[model samples]
Target: MSGVTRDDRVHVLGIRHHGPGSARAVATALAELNPQIVLIEGPPELDAVAPLAAAQGMRPPVAGLVYAVDAPSTANFYPMAVFSPEWVALRWALDHGREVRFLDLPANVSLVLADEEESEAPMDPIRTLAEAAGFDDPERWWEDAVELRYHGLDIFHAVLDAMHTLREGHVPDLRTRRREAAMRRVLRAALRSEASTIAVVCGAWHAPVLVPSAFPTQAADSALLKNLRTTKVAATWVPWTSTRLARMSGYGAGIESPGWYHHLFTARDQVVGRWLVRVAHLLRREHLDVSSAAVIEAVRLAQALSVLRNRPHPGLPEVLESCQAVLCGGSDVPMRLVARKLLVGDILGGVPRETPMVPLARDLDATRKRLRLKQSAAQQDLDLDLRTQSHLDRSKLFHRLLLLEVPWAESAETSRTKGTFRESWTLEWKPELEVALIEASGFGTTIPSAATAVVAQRTAEADIAELSTLVETTLTADLPVALSGVLAALDERAARQHDITRLMAAVEPMARVRRYGNVRRADTELVQRVLTGIVTRITVGLPAACTAVDEEAGRELRELIDGVQRGIGLLDQRELRAVWLSALRSVADRLGVPGIIAGRAVRLLLDAGLLDVTDAGGRLSRQLSMASDATQAAGWLEGFLSGEAALLVHEPELLEIVDQWATGVDAELFDHLLPLLRRTFAEFTATERRDIGLRVKRIDRGAGASGIRSDDTTLDHERASLVVPGILELLR
Candidate 1:
């Protein structure tokens, strides 16, 4: 049987969801047909709110939000832009006083079905057909064939024919079949109730299936959707953004460029001129040298490109190419600015204040307004200097939100100029985070209180390492109310945990947070007290932990020792510093410790002034003595001097000792020791390695004084005298 059959009474108006062309065509068709009942393919749950679209200040780029009453997180969005065909059709019905209603399956079934994520099918039949027809991108083909070329009934007919051919080779899953059946049942009921014709606006792909003559039997359709488990759902309108209207936000039927389409729908008469003017405005604001002349040239070039490409109007590609050539000087930097600001306009739609939202989301929005941190869909970079109270407050709110897993703000890398004083964040608001906020509302009423409650709950079962991370998050979030509980938990965990490696690993982050506390003006007395105890335990147990470890275990222990050394270096109390240095001295002198650990121990002792230069030299000689094999001597050398190139670079005596050790080892032993030596030297910077090599060359050739050249002797006096005045003039 044929996939589609014609019916005169039902005017099936197929449309691209957010296409400007489709919106125009649908509007024209609705005006011409003048149907009494308009059945739109939208969630039926939002039918009551449909009239809200006609209300004053009810803007486009807003969405009808439907979520399960039992599980608000199980939600779906049906977003509409100013150029959307459904939006246009609904507006027409509202203006003409025609009855308008949503005819698709309700959100109760859709949200449940959405929860069962289907595995991606290996192939798409529509994509295959587009490819077979020699179009690499199916969307481009759809635009060129149906959207860009047709109007009124021609577009609907073209879409119907294309979808019919595609569907002939495609077999939809049961879920799709059920949805279509439900839609058909609704349309049949509408036809029966309304004597006048009913106009159906739906996705172009569903037009063929919705025809009354081709629809499945009413009895079978009812059985397919009968007795399905459903929960009550509530819906409200929420603001959306142009960026989220793009396909990247995972909207199934999203458009590529909402800004461009909006222009096509509203400003089609002078799209190129207005777009170039917008670009020129952005460039002038950025202080780039753009002018009226450049704008005029860009318009001309866009028209020329359009004519060359045989297009009726200048498309996005033409405008972009013209922009790159005329205004950007063939450089992509200015063009990128144009694309970001103009092509993807940062216009965020607004819903009526009376729209319903979960308490957490409502509270979050209020707090955001109070903090002057406006929510936007576009990603914006924010740099905060902790010295400022407002910036600090913004940072704290972001951290708290992160704790709740809202993920609206992400901490970026530290700023380059002001290291400790500044923090950076990339903030982008996603609509789905409303669900996360709803889930977290069970904790507390506000972001700060909720974050504190959450941290306290997690701290109950957290270990020392996890608690260490939690403490840093709490500090960054500025949650002083929860700090005491987390600190107490940390102290209790630290008292019970005897693993030296874990203790050492946890100390550095805690110490860093404590150090940052002074900058943030946050209370750090508990952190300081906890860190002191942690340091004392690490100092006492480190010597024992270093004993009898294998090479791999030695590497891990070495990292912990390094962390401890760095942590102790940042401590304020002199008594603690003395104890840490004493611990290092003991570890250095101990027998049977891994050579790498002993080397680190000796380096730390030397750095702390516990060992003089003479003592260091004598220790190096003994460690590299002929009594030990090349492997053992190499290991010892690697421990003390692996990452400390400055000492060797400046001190010839240490360099001479290393040279003697290298000469003393036999070729096979040297070959066996090459890897360890290479590993040790690899940590040094390139200049350090090169300088060391040059110093060694000087020592090997005994030419330190023989090759010295006087700078004055090489100068040409007459030439220098001639250029001195010119150099002075240039400098002045």
Candidate 2:
């Protein structure tokens, strides 16, 4: 039978699963009905695997998916977030003595439900007409009508009518309409036979069509359900968080506005306090001295924010701000990660509240523990004294390549030396892996992480040069950590051309990396540089490098470069000046051919004052030369030389190209002037360098203090940086 339910009058509840307002309404609606034959929208195959849900160790993110039996690879997962409405519906059925059934046509039928023919489909006539109606954004139109405002319970009835029109208007195909129509019949039958008010659950979009009169009714057929595929699937429970939800990841069913909605689900008065307690508890686990005072202050701040914002309940934002003020003391790094501990944690529960583990992972986990593996976060020095001979062999082999215990991994690694065997795993608990593990969960929990580990270890063993796909996938999956790990994994991968598409894909997470801020130090240099590099990479390669959906993204890349550059540029005056000077020089260098993209670079640099090299004032280089002394100044030479960044007068060709754009040089003459400026820097003198750096600094400070990072306390006021100008002068 087709895995999709094949039933008559099947009740389908269209819902935005996990949506608090929807869930609350659905629960209220369901409570009024006691359907004996409650059929929820899941793969019917899950009926065969219901035992897995109750299996002693099944976790979340596990799903009983349906695919073509002949083709196991083409499968669609029925994801189950903890807050999924389908999950709640099933639970209601289980508790109320109802015979719950998944009434979709069997997987085999639904998956391969072809009409035995193809048709040249007609386009929507209304869509053409809608152009005059200002229906430019279809999604926006839908959002306005249905995706917003959920204060009423009669919305279901309103939706029921809308589905009728939507099905005829949207799905013009007769064959597809019949499939949905048959399900409605199945829903009705389930409702009638059970003497129960049946509650049908489906996505909100589907509800408007499936009502009794919305579409044509069709009889369920065995032929309609046959010729599909099936797979033995399992289910599991996984913790979730709002931040990730905000990312709109996965199949788009993950709840949006989790922070906003969570208030409705959880107790209001205690949430902020609970969050603080959880944070303090997590900190305590990490051995941070989070005092009660911190928690109290955080609570007070949350209350203050709630009052100021006119919210009766203190929201996540308030709680977060409070936590940041009290615990972070300004830096939000630890607090964000800690919030994840409370929000989407590593703790996983089994489906059915008691599914058992998969075999391999279970066994491996048992072995690991028996071998006395510490489950706590890994540390710098770890000596796994393999007690058994085979264990010893595995350990030696692991060490031989994957471990690479040259010196650092030898239980004595430090920051100074690149350590071997000092494993750095950026851990994230994907509930899907637990589902993947549940199939193997019987074997033990180790199989999943172990299988992943084996794949990771193999890049080293098999070599990423040959296994380039693995390297790319790793990057696509989680870049900074994954790519960093792959670097070690390859130990010798060649400089494969940059796949900017793959790199840009990491922008979201990479952006998140800057949360590691030490605010007091005032040197946002690290994050600034990272953002600059990413923006630079994108801006330079865009407009053609990535094609497809990336066309839109390319425009965004230019926008993002400006945004990030602006953000970093807003640093306090001194730091901002230093950055501007350095960045402008970079623009000059990058403008040369075969260098990074520079159309945007030159404008940003010159406009930002990094290119003050054309002498806006008198000869500061000569002024500093005759008047400056090294005695009272700590590092005159260093300051002047460092200002080489500001002084980076480009060679002729690039400058001429810029002149063509900004200075309006005639094409032929512009081309001629390009080469001369290109060569100018190669022969520039010390006097020239000193004048540029001194001029930029002199303008900023009037010789107050030349500060670059020389020592932590001391700067290149006039020390080593002066040598660059001197060297350039000597060459001249």
- Highest TM-score, which number? 1
* TM-score of model 1 vs. true structure: 0.85
Clashes of 2: 101
lDDT score of residue 678 within candidate 1 = 80
Model 2, residue 708: distance off in Å is 36
lDDT at residue 60 of model 1 (Cα atoms): 76
lDDT of 2 by residue, 1-732 (tens): 110123433344556645554555556666754555666665556666554543455544344554443443334456554455666676677666666666554455444443354533433322332344454322222223443543334555554444445555554354444444545655656656735355677665556555554444243433443444434433223333344453333223543344334444454357567768877887788777789988988899898987887654565667777887888777777876764555544333334433334454355446555645433211233443333443443343223222221111132323422112222222233333333433322222343344345445556665423343343333322223434455444323322326544434433333333322221111334444544454455444543442233324434544444544544444333553454346434533431211112323434554566555343112123222324321111121122222233333433222222222323434565356444333433344566745443433322222222322233345575686776685454334
Candidate No. with top lDDT: 1
Model 1 CA lDDT for position 145? 64
User: How far out, in Å, is residue 528 in model 1?
Assistant: 2.9
In angstroms, the error of model 2 at 612 is 56
Model 1 C-alpha lDDT per residue in residues 375-439, reported as the tens digit of each score? 78788999888889888888888989999999998988843222287888999887677668877
- Candidate 1's displacement at residue 374, Å, is 2.5
Write down the worst ten-residue block by lDDT for model 1.
701-710
